[model samples]
Target: MEEQRAPGQWWRYGPPWSRYGPPWRGGPDEAEPQHGNRRPWRSTALLTAFVLIGSNFAAHDQPHRVPLDPYARVLLLITSLLLLWRHRYPVPVAFGTATLTLGYLAAGYPYGPVFLVVAVACYSAVVAGHRRAAWASMGLLWTGHALVALWLYRWLPPAGDTRAGLTQEIVIATWVLAIVALSELARVRREQWARERADRAQAARRRADEERLRIARELHDVLAHSISVINVQAGMGLALLDSDPEQARAALTTIKAASKEALGEVRQVLDTLRASGAAPRTPAPGLDRLPELVEQAAAAGLTVEVEGEQPPLPPGADLAAFRIVQEALTNVVRHSGSRHARVVFAHDGDALRLRIDDDGPATGADAGGSGNGLAGMRERAAALGGTIEAGPRPDGGFRVLAVLPSRLKEDQ
Candidate 1:
C-alpha cells in the first residue's frame, strides 16, 4: 500500500529541487536572509506578546496592576511597537522592553509579558550573530527582575519573601541564558554548512570544465597530425607527376598508403571516444611510436637523427614523450630552415629525459600557428609531473628538452 503524505506537509517540490523547478521558489536548504525587514516568527512573537499584555488590563489583578488609564495604556502600546524591532536592533529592543516592564511592575501593572519579550529579544541577538549583545540583553533583563523582586519583598499586599523571589529570578535568568547560547550555536553551524556547500559546488564546476578541455585537446591531437600528413603527401605526389613518371607513381602510392593509414588512425581514435561506456581500448600512439614520427618528419623533407637509449615507460610518461617529440619535429618541419634535426632520449634512473634540436633560426622560430603544438607538449609533461623548456640554441638552431619523473605522478 502506498503511504500517504500529509496535505499540510506536502510541497510542490522537495529537497535538492531541480534548476528548472518553480522559477521563484527556492530550495528548502537555501540560507535565510540575514538582514531582513522582519522575520515572520519575530513578527508573530510581537503580536502574541501585545495581545497578552493588553488582555492583562481587564484581568483579575494581583499586586502588580498599573492602572489601565490612558497614560499606562499608551506606554504599553509603545512597548509593543518596540518589540516588533527586536530582530533588527536586538540590544536596544531588549533595553526598551525591559525598562517598560520594570516601570509597569513598580507602578503595580500586571506582569503578563515580561518573559515573552525578553526571550524573543535574546533569541534575536543570537540569530544576528551577536552573542555578546544577547548576554547584555539577558543581564539587563535579570537586573530588572531583581529590582522588581526587591520591590515586591519590601511592600505591597500579599508581600513576597525577598529570598524566594531572588532565587526564582536567578533561575529564570539562567534558562534565558541557556536558550540564547544554544540558539547562537545552531546559527553558527548553519553558516558553516552553507560555506562548505558553496565550496563543493565550485569545485565540481571546475572539474567539469577541466574534463571538457581534455576532450577537446584529445580531439585536436587525433585530427591535426593526420590532416597534416595527408596534405604533405598529396602535395609531394602532385609535384612529381609528368616530369618524373616513375617517381610520381611512387609518390602516388605513398599518398595512398598515408591516406589509408590516416583513415585507420582516425577511426581508432573515434572508436575509443565512443567506447566511454565500454572497457577502454589500448592507447593508439605513444613514445614507442617515435620512430614513425621521425620517419614522417623525414618524408616532410627534414632529416631526423634518433639518438640515446629509450627505455620501457609508464603510460603517462609515454604520452608525454610522444607529444614532446611530435611537437618538436612538427616545429622543425614547419619553421626550421635547416635540413638536419636530432632527437635524443635518455633514462636517468629516477627520470626520463628528452631533447630535440633542429638547425632552425638561432633567434628562434616564428611564434605563430595555433601555438598548441608546444603548449600541448608542455601540458602533457606537466600532467605527468614533469617539465619542459623550448628556446633557441647557442648554435644556429631551436631546441626542446623535457624531463618526465620515473614515478609519473601529478602534483594535483
Candidate 2:
C-alpha cells in the first residue's frame, strides 16, 4: 500500500521528509538548526516573561476586559513554551500555540504581547517548510476568534462585549498574509544559496581532474623520449667498448648529457607536485626547442630532415606542437626500422600545420604505436580546438599530421 502523507505536511526534501513518505515532514533536515534545539531556553524564557508582563499592562488599559489572573498568565506562558521544541515538532507546536492563543481570547483576556508567541510559532513552521500546517493553525486561531467575538461573546466572560467588526478581521488577515510572504522569500534564498555552493564544489573537482591529466601526460612524454635515447647510447657503448674504446667513450659522454637533461626536466615536473602554487623554475619548452629534439634523435641514431617555416603559435598550442614533434621522433627511434625521418611545418590560413613521416617497410607497433602517445597528442590539440591525425601511410611509411590554431589564446 502507498503511504499516505499527513495533512498540512511539507513537500518531501532534506533528510527529515525522505523516510517519512513524500517530501512532507517539516523537520529541518538531519542536524537541527544551530540556533534551534541547542538553546531555546533563553528565547522562550524571554518570550514567556514578556507575554506575562505585557498582558498586565494591557489589562490596566482595557478595564472592560477580564482582569489578569493566575490562570491567564500560566496560559500565556504555556503558549510561549511550545516553541522550545518548535524545530523538531513544527506542526504540533504551530497547532499547540495557535489553539492556546484562541483559548486566551475565549477567556476575554486583554490582547498584548500574547500574540507574539503565535507569530513566532508560525514563523518557525513556515521557515521549516511546513507552510500548509502553519496556515491551518493560524486559520484555526482566527476562525475561532471570529466565532467568539461575533456570536458566542454574549455567553462568555466580562459582559457587554460588542460583535467584532469586519474591518478588524480584515486587518488581522493582512498581517498574517504578510508574515507568510516573508517566510516564503526566506525559503527561496536558502535553497538558492545551497545550489550555488554545490555548483562551486563541482567546478573545483573538474579543475583538479584536468590538472592531474596534464601532469600525467608531461611525465609520459619526458620519460619516454629520454629513456629511448639513453637505451640507444647504452647499447652502442657496450658494443664498441673493446674494439673502439674512443667511440665507446663518446657514447658514454652522450649518455651522461642525456641523463643530466632528463633529470633537470624531471625535477622541473616534480617541483609542481611538491609545491603546487610555486612558479616553475624553467619556462615551458616550445617549437624553438626543435634543435634539441633533432639532437636527441641524432643521439638515438636517427637523422631528422626539416622543411618549411614553422609558424608562431599560442603558448598552449606552442607547447602541444613541441610535445607532438618530440613524441613522433621518439616513436621513430623506438619502433621504426628507418634511420631517416622528415618534419615539415606549413601555414594554412590562420592555422599552423605539422607533419612528421618516416620511410618504413614494416615494424610491429611502428607509427600506430599502441595509441598511448597518439592519444596524449590528440588530448593536447583538442584542448585548444586543434586536431591530430597519425597512421601508417598507404604506400608504406608512418605519418603524424597536426593542425593547431595560431591565435587560440587571444580568441579564448
Best lDDT goes to which candidate?
2
For model 2, what is the alpha-carbon lDDT of residue 402?
96
lDDT of every predicted structure (CA atoms): 0.67, 0.84
User: What TM-score does structure 1 among the candidates reach?
Assistant: 0.65
Best of the candidates, TM-score? 2
Superposed by TM-score, candidate 2 places the C-alpha of residue 361 at a distance from the truth, in angstroms, of 6.5
Count of backbone clashes for each model?
A: 4, 3
- lDDT (10s digit) by residue, model 2, range 1-412: 8447675443322233333323455543643444334436557877888888888888899998999889988898888888877877989999999999999989998978878888888888888889999989888988898898889999997788888899988887886777677777877888788899999999999999999889878977887788778887888999999999998998898888888988988899999789879988899889999999998899879999999998878788989999999999988888888999999999888888899999975466332234478889999989888899999999888999999998765547
Each model's TM-score, in the order given?
0.65, 0.79
Candidate 1: tens digits of C-alpha lDDT, residues 1-412:
8437677533322222332234675653443434354234446545666656655644456434444656656666666656656665777876776677566556555556545656666677677777777777677666766765665546742244333455677787787678777777777887899889999999999988876665556655654555555555567778877677787676666656656766776677667668876644656567778878767766666788999888777776776677677767767766777878999978777898899998776334433346677777777778767899998888768889998876634652
Instruction: Name the Cα RMSD for model 1.
Output: 8.5
Worst 10 residues of 2 by lDDT: 12-21
